[model samples]
Structures are given as structure tokens and as C-alpha cells.
Target: MTSTPLHKGIHPVLEQDHPYIFIDACMQAWPDADYAHAHRHGVTAYAVTAFHPWAGLDEALEGLMFWHLSARRHSHLGIAWIAEDIRHAKREGRAVFVLASQGGDFISNALHRIEAFYRLGLRMLIPAYSRTNAICGGCLDRADGGLTSFGELVVAECNRVGLLLDCSHVGKRSSLEIIERSAAPVVFSHSNPKRLVDNPRNIDDEQILACAARGGVIGLAPWGPLVMKPGSRTRPTLDDFVEHIDYVAQLTGSADHIGIGTDMSLGTYPDHEHDPWGEPAYAAVTREYDQHVTADVRSPLRAVEGFSSYPEVLNLVDRLQRRGYGEADVRKILGENMLRVFEQVWR
Candidate 1:
């Protein structure tokens, strides 16, 4: 797995990074079967999404409890209660799991559900997916009503209950409100930069600075279409992904607020390593690319070279070192930043 973009060797110090916490802040879902491979690939902890778009209370509990059961049954999977728990879990040779939800609809306008979920070991919540909900606005809705009165309560409740707030897939207006209102740092768990790809799912400079201003970290996603250069004809390579780290670092004058949120599932397109944009998640963006862009939509849409699976993630450490990032910054981008947020909000 020494496949970094270009030549310079890894920094000698980084080569000995045994106790570092490498967290993938956003993995859409992590089934119990993948726990061994996740740890084998150096995964320390991850935020695994549980519920779906319109999943109500019953479905929500079912989704969350699945992970709880996994941790109990599987020796390789450990449940992380606080940010510090990740450190202990990693030392114990387990891949820690942070229970997360991608949408707030699961709560069904019941704020008490937040506290219940917290008690159940759910540590992060994304309030909205891709559609408008009672709590907040969505990224692809008819209008941008920003965060509503109910959404404000959700934010306060999240703050009180130690649930990490995520803004990915949320509307710009609503995302901004969450960033400002949160007493603790926030996260865009699985988003890219709009300057690179121009997708609505990607955030702009204003959003970037606002998030960073409040001491938050934005996880850079490796999802092909989201971070590929605007007008690019090929899929995102290791360098293509690192280019984003470069872009955001240069944009903010620091790498303290950046991390990796893979936003992908390992072994998804197994037969086809470079998966096509045919999944339900890519629906809206694919349509927009096909209709508005220069018809390069179906150009094998990631049917070319790219960062394909999870086990290949260590290559990123190589890539960042090749790109001249120092050890502390690279560590922050890898997992420390997310840990800092969790500790501050959850403690």
C-alpha cells in the first residue's frame, strides 16, 4: 500500500506513528462484518450513520441498536463513549464506533429522543439529510428557510446532550445557523469544497470560514464527483484527494480545521473498484451534471482511476507527507481535530 502520488518518502517520524487516532469522521454505514478489516486498515474510530431519510422512531432505534449489539458480540468492535474512549479502544486493538445519524427525521419532532439516543451511546447527529425537515433546511430543497424555531431547540439539545452537530447535506442557510448557534465546534462530516467541484453538496468559502471561525473541523471527503476538479474528465486519484487538503489548508492558513470524512462504504463496488455514480445517493448530482454541464456526465463517472476502498486509506498519509504537510498538522487532519471537538462537546 505504498501507492502515494509522487516520490518523496514518508517523514521518518510519521513512520513510527503507532498510537495515533485515525478516524474517518463520516462513513455512511459500517456493517458488523467489516470490523476486522476496518481495524486491519488502521481505523481507530468512525462516525457510522444509522438511520435513513424518513426513518421514524422505530426504525431509528433499530438502526442504532444494531451497532450496540455489534459491539457486544464482536471483540474487534468497541463502543466509544467519550472522545477519550477512542484512545483506550485503539490501544486495546479494537476499531471504535461512534453511533451517528444522518437525518433528524428519526426523532419525529420529539426532542426527548435526543437524550434517549445519547443515553443509548449515539454521539453525533446531522439534523437533516437532503430534504427539508421540521428541524432545519436541506441542501436540495425548494427554498432555503434557514434553521427554524424547532431547529434552534435541536441545536440547544444537541449541545446539552453531548451530541456532535454535523452540517453535511444540510441547506446553506441552516448550516450557517447551526455553525453560529452551536456552543461547541461543529463538523461537515462528509462534504467537499464547492470551489473545486461546484456541487451544492460542497460548501463555499463563506461557510468554510464560518465553520472554522467557531473552531470546527471540516472533513474532506474522497467521494469522486464531490471533490474532482470542476470540468475534470477523470475520477479522483490520490493526488486529486490531497489537492483538496491543499486547497482548504491554503484557504484557511491552517490544517487544524480539516479531517477526513470518507463518506463511502468499503467493498461497495468490489467487482468494479472504481464504482459508477449509479447509487441512490448520487441521484441529484448526477442529474445536474448530465443536464447542466458539458455532457461529461456519463464519461464513466468514476469508472476511471480513483480512491476506491477503505483499506487503501493509509496511502493518504503517504500522499500528505509527499505534499509537504508537517507531522502535527497531518495528525490533526487525520483524527486529532475530530477528537478535540468530541472532547469539548461531549465532556
Candidate 2:
């Protein structure tokens, strides 16, 4: 017997009809076999990477099968490691993969590497992440510096290659710096508005306005701290998530500048097990030396109930649809808006 969609009981409309959802902001670290679990709810996975593969390219390729199987019903992909995955996915008729880099760390202070990676299909580059890198500083950095000399070259090269510049992890000063220097539309692929929630990772009103003014789209991530306040452990409800979307809509002057990346590392690790809080398996061990570092982000896995599964995003969307969002708006929020930005900046 077929199981009901995750939103079935929550929303009567979902009981009978589940909307087709194309996820654009998924990570590649999760096991590939898990895609089928997402597919059961009508989600098509578009796997993205941060360019730092643990076992290298060969192992990363192994995850594509999971992406291919869920293609017919759902397909949207990108973010770092794009050259290999994008070409392969396109050839397989799975879906178009949009290349993205989580941080400028991959470039290793060289524009030649940036050029080579772009030629290989790198469409977007995040200038910074959780720490200071060659290009610039991240949100967590003590000083929010923007676009180093190398970062300038990286942005120019991205323009030359038609790759988009992303500022999600870049600090406030850096985000604006990139915005001012970028010739193409820039993105905050998986960030929330600080106006709603006070996280440093979340963008403030000015940042949101700048992104929209440049014709760039801001992908609101559904992760907890960026959107809600539930004591120290409980996850935010769907309403909290919508409030973020709504706040962004008001900030950007339209929903077209807003989209959902979800940042849902679903089927991956729960809150307590993720990085910045968990052991430093991926980054430096000393990064987590202070136990207080993981405080707010730690505990009870703040993922929305029924929303953790990839397919449930559409359920949230449909709920928004009923609340009076036009179909055109829905289309943009789903994937069209991001695609528009991609086509403009990605060669």
C-alpha cells in the first residue's frame, strides 16, 4: 500500500493531491539510497556540494544515482563541485544542475583555479564561510572585511565566466562589498533575514534590499536560528518559517526576490550531530574547543515537524498558495526565480 504524503492529514488538500517539488539547495553528503525515501513524498532531489569532498570526485559521483532516480518528478541541482555533477546530470536527462561553492576556500588564493573550476562548470562562489579564508571573512569572523584583492579577481573572473557570486556566508561588510563590486546578480543561497531573527548568519534589511535591487534572489533557509526562537531546543513551526518568507517579501518588495533553499540537510544529521556543535571532523578540531559555541544551534533538532523531509516543502508552499500567494509567485519561490538568476550569471 502507498503511504500518505507527509502533509496529508495536516492539510486536507494534500491528502488527495501532492504537488511536484523541485529542491534546489540540497547537500551531497547524505547517502544516495536515501533519495527514495524523499521520492515517496514526491520530492526530486537536486544535490549540491561545497567543493570539499571527503573522498574526492569519485565518491561524490556515487551520489548522482540518487539524484537521477528522482529526476522525473523532481530535479534541481547545484552549488560547488558543479563541473562534474552538472555535466553528468545534464547528460543523464536528470535535470539542470546549477554550480555553487560554499566558500572561497576552494580557490586557495588563486584566480586560475577559479577560472579552471568555472570552465568545469562552477556557476556560483561564496566568498566566505564560517571562518576567514583567503578571499574574505565569514559572518563569524571578528572583523567583517569584504572582497580582498584576490576576491576582486574572483568576482571579475566569475563575471568573465558568467558564474554568479554568492554572499550567504560572507560577513555583513563582505556581503555589501561583493554586492557593490559584482557585475552580475549575487545570491544568498541559504540565508534568512536578521530583521526577523537576530542571528549573525541572517541578513539584515539593508542586505536584503541590496540583493533584490541588483536583480539577485535571496534564498531563505529554513534552518531554526535563522527563522525562529524556541527556547533552547524546540524547532520552529511552519508558521515561523512563513513569517521569514513574509518578512523577506516585505524587505525585497516582492516574493520574486525570495525563494526557499530550506538548507534542510535532511536524512543527513540532526541538529546535535551537525558541525559547529559536533566534533570537528570536517574543519579544524579547535573550532569546537569551546562548548558554548554550539549552544543555541544544539539540542532537540529544531527542524519543523513534517518539514524535515524534502517533499514537505511543497506542502508548506501549497499552504502559502492557499493564503493568497499567486501561482506566478509560487513558481518563482519554488525554483523559477533562482533559475532566472542562474541564466543571467552562469555562462
Candidate 3:
């Protein structure tokens, strides 16, 4: 029996790397599943933020939401009201805090609130999630409309304040409009190329190209849905993940426009649970729904097949050595592309 080879080329020089990663954003459901442990991975930098249930006007609750993150060094915990704590964390060499919202709902239809959040170190905003709200429509929405008037205002203000606007969950039309409206380069923080998996959540080839044309970076996620073929009975393998990355690189014609987000949900939430905020966790919606679970969504084993951690992922450079992606290209996919987007949009 032959073992699988995870890498083929020279291993990446992670020691020289800042080891920085923007997890795109995630919910706090299970710590072991969703949160990245720097000590475990030897990751030097991370910008961690919540994914949903916009932090409301309650400052105390918001503080509590982010307070736990302060204990971790080299993490950027995100929340709406933890500005002071985030600043302090950054100074302490903990995690640099970055306030992020999954939807514009954090401001509740008020674009002015963006300025307030920006003042508080809000670095990124997702115009929509699976559902549309006041500012813009989402991909799952039936209307398929573009950004609303307020959405445009928010985009402009995000630009003015030097915030990175993430179009990952926005509707196809809205994402296109946002690229046109943003004054700064935008990001598709944790998306994959639809050409590979045909997911509505993934960006289309044209969308990928448009984003790259505006100096934006699209971070590819290493999750079940992104790499799986529709109706296929197969768990995502390293080759599948690389295929999506390769497709995006081809779509953009440069590895510099793509980066890895991984989107690994290690310990955040139970795979079978779904609920908003403090609401009760919902069980699998229906018995029929149980049958919908695809092979790709199977609970990931510790190492996720070939790679267990970021360092393991670096081994990909070795695997693709003869695939025409050189060391520089590998570095770009691992972090440089994201850094370029960060420097451009987080000004």
C-alpha cells in the first residue's frame, strides 16, 4: 500500500513569514472547532472576529463578547464595542483586534454608524450574509438585487475610513455593484471559485476576475462545500482544494490575487446546530434534512487528511513543485496576496 504525498516542491519558509492570517470571520460555537490556537500552530499573527448577530447597543455585553479573546496572544478579536480593549491587546502583543460584521445589520440601516465603528477600529464589513438586510441583498435572496442606496453610502464611507469591504456573502449583483462603488480595493475574504464546485456561495469566474482587476484579493476557504462537486459522494481531498486554488489563479492570471483562508471550523459550533445569538440552538431542521448531509460535510478528522495545521499546509508548495507554481507564487497564495489586500484596504 502506498501512502499519499501531501507535498512535492520545497517546503515554504514559514519562519520568515509573519504567520499572519485573517480568519475571514467565524462564530463562537465550539472553541476547539472554530478558534485557531496560535500555540498549537505556531501562528504569529491572527485577526479574529465574530461572524454574526451584530453586536448591538449594549457595550457591556459586547465587551464580554470580546473579553475572552484578550487572553490569547497574537489574536485580533473583533466586536463592535471592544475598541479600548482591542487597542490594549495590540499593545500587549496579544491579538490585534479587528471589529468585523457579517452584515450591515450592526448599524441597523444607519450608514453613519459605520463611521462610529470605524473610529473604534472596525476594519472590515460584510454587506450581507445568507439573508439580505437594510443595506444590501444576499446571495440566497430570491430578488437578486444589487446594493441599496444606503449600501452605496456604506461602501463609500468604508472607503473613506479605509475599511476593507468584504463582498463574500453579498448577492451576485450587489457584489458587482460594490466593486464599482468601493473607493478602495475590496475582498472576498473566504470564498472559492464557483467554477470548481458550482456553489452559489462561491464566486464565479467573472466575479473573481473583476475583484482581481480592482486589486482585490479572494481568499479561498478549505471547507467541504467549496471543494466538493455538486451531488458527488466524496470528501474533499488536498487535490480538490488545490484545484480550486489553481482555478482561481487561472481566473485571475496571477497567484498574487489569491490567498488561503482555510475556514476551518475546528471547534466553534456543532455541525448539527444552528441558531442566532442567545437564541436556543436548533437541531437539524427536519428529519428529511438529515438525508441532505453530504459526504463532504462529514466531521473532519484531526488533520483533515493531508494537512493538520498551517505549517502542514505550507507543504503544498512542495507538492506542486513541478506544477509551474514556484516559491514566490506559493508565498503569494499563503499570505502575500492577503497582505496586499490588507495594506490597500486597511489603510
The whole-model lDDT of each prediction reads 0.75, 0.60, 0.59
Q: Give a tens-digit lDDT track for model 2, residues 1-347.
A: 14432321111112322433354553433442243233243333343653442223333233333333344344443232333443344344333434456766656655776677666655666767666677777777677677688877877888887877878878888888888888988888888877666776778888999889999988877665565552334456677788788888876677889766765543333233346655432322112212322343222233454454455666677777877888788877876677667667766
| TM values, all candidates | 0.85, 0.74, 0.75
The alpha-carbon deviation from the true structure for residue 269 of candidate 1, after best TM-score superposition, in angstroms, is 7.8
Q: Flag regions of model 2 displaced more than 4 Å.
A: 1-21, 35-47, 53-97, 230-233, 270-300
- In terms of lDDT, model 2 sits at 0.60
Q: Judged by TM-score relative to the true structure, which candidate is superior, 1 or 2?
A: 1
Q: Which candidate has the top score in TM-score?
A: 1
Candidate 3 lDDT over 1-347, as tens digits, reads: 11332221111223433333323232222344323333233232334444444445464236435524543422443332333443343344343334556666777766677777666556677878756777787876667678888788888888887778888878888899999888788888778887776776788977888889899888787665556666655455677678877888777777878876654432333343446666432222122212443332333421234543455664565565657888788767765676666666664
lDDT of 1 by residue, 1-347 (tens): 43432211111112223556788888745342444445555678978876665689999899888888877777877788998889887777668788888899987778999999899988988888878899988897878799989999999999998889999999999999999899988999988888877887889988998998898989988766676566665555778778888988988889989988876553232222344765334325644344433233213233114444444455777788888888898789989999888888884
Q: Give candidate 1's TM-score.
A: 0.85
Ranking by lDDT: 1, 2, 3
Each model's total of backbone clashes: 0, 4, 19
Off by over 4 Å in 3: 1-42, 51-55, 59-98, 270-298, 301-304
Output the worst ten-in-a-row residue range by lDDT, candidate 2: 7-16
